[model samples]
Target: MKRRFTVSVILSRCSLASSWIFYSEYFYNYQNEGRVEWVYGDGFAHNLNNVNNLVSSLRFVGDEDNWKMDSITLFEFDLFFGIEYYDWTDNTQVPSGMSTVGSLIITGQNYWTVYTSTNFSGNRACLQVQSGQYVGFAADLDEYGIFTVRSYRRGCFGDKKITLNSDQHGFAVKARE
Candidate 1:
């Protein structure tokens, strides 16, 4: 028998000088037990007006000693399955077939330190980060028959002409008779 699922996207207003963007997709199989999976893409951008003015003014006054500022772009994708039982023993490990190019970190399992790297894929499975702890569970596996998927970004401050953008999107599923 097939099961029913629903998805939603909630967005907050962008800051006066900031912007946020995010998108995500989800999949699930209830007949096979309570199996759930999802993937998301997020982007962040900030304006650069102060830096530009500082450079131009220094050049005009012939005082171009040197000035510098840091700019960063962060991108991430997360894929995982949710189960009802706390024990993940029979969950199947499958790849999403999608990749990202940027600074990335993947962590799961309780009390385990974050693994920092340029790329991460397929090495870690059945592990989840919840309440700052890494927990593992199985797929098609349901004890309470409920699961959740989520993604988001936090905002920060900036100067004039400098705008920041933040956005997020994802999905979820629940078992019903």
Candidate 2:
């Protein structure tokens, strides 16, 4: 039997312009990170039904040219195999005048949700999944105070285990198969 796993991210209270830029930068950075590939919208949609080890990154890159600020929410989802893996990070800091409130990671049987707030101070939160649950972990923030979450599977392949970081800027989670 094949199992599907999905990961999603949602950002609340951000301007459309910023959202676009943020997402663009996110995809750019993800490609730079070299851990995953940039799968466009069509590629993502087409692969959702298959059980494979795939990583999809979606960002709400806000419009930087517009001086106007608009509250925005960003959400993304990924689906793969139960024993598959996916990971991401928002290394870039919000624009100077922008604020990030908070972030949340909700893990389910076949899907996970990550939510980020607009207020800068409030946007510093991380969620890690271990044994099919969100494991509160530590995070390490850069000079810009951008929060990130890193997760992977450990143990003997099928008997994998998860480890999570217990910090505000960075988080890690391990899961066992």
Candidate 3:
């Protein structure tokens, strides 16, 4: 006999998060370059005309930054599902045989930048790392724009350290500014 699996079982194995983007068919041009036809979020995609696979460029228009601190994990499917690519170091391009990026997982105390095209060209989004303690699970790239990730660079803000010390009055204080 052979063991069988279900979609729910497979989903349960990996953690899930809320947030997604409506990918377009062209590069970022103030939404004028292409039409927004693919909506992916919360672990599923509303694919139309197979536009989800044709996303080429994206630009984050908002000022929001900061993401969960963890090792980078790129998913081939929305909502942090499918073909997971985990890495701690930066890369100029996606892994061999992997092309599209549906989601991201940023780790550690350093912010990372994910680009739409290779060599950090084309559209880009800077995922800032949360300050203080690291949260195990983080929100997926929420509305960061719609473009597949091709290359990524770590240490967006470099390594930040916070030191605690006791002052003369025995009161805990942050060491540096």
Q: Which sections of candidate 1 miss by over 4 Å?
A: 1-90, 95-126, 132-177
lDDT (tens digit, per residue) of candidate 1 on 1-177 = 321111222232111111111112122121321322222121222232212111111100001121011112112221122111111122121123313211111222222111112122122222222343211212221221212211111121111111111112222333443
Q: What RMSD, rounded to one decimal, does every model reach?
A: 21.8, 18.7, 16.2
What is the full ranking by lDDT, best candidate first? 3, 2, 1
The TM-score that candidate 2 achieves is 0.18
Q: Cα miss at 131, model 1 (Å)?
A: 3.4
Task: Compose the digit string of candidate 3's lDDT tens values, residues 76-106.
Answer: 6444333557776788999976666665555
The better candidate by lDDT, 2 or 3, is 3
Single out the weakest 10-residue window by summed lDDT for candidate 1: 58-67
Count of clashes, each model: 13, 52, 4
Name the runs in model 3 displaced over 4 angstroms: 1-70, 135-142, 157-177
What TM-score, to 2 decimals, does candidate 3 have?
0.46
C-alpha RMSD of candidate 3? 16.2
Residue 158 in model 1: shift from native, Å? Answer: 43
Query: Each model's C-alpha lDDT?
Result: 0.20, 0.24, 0.42
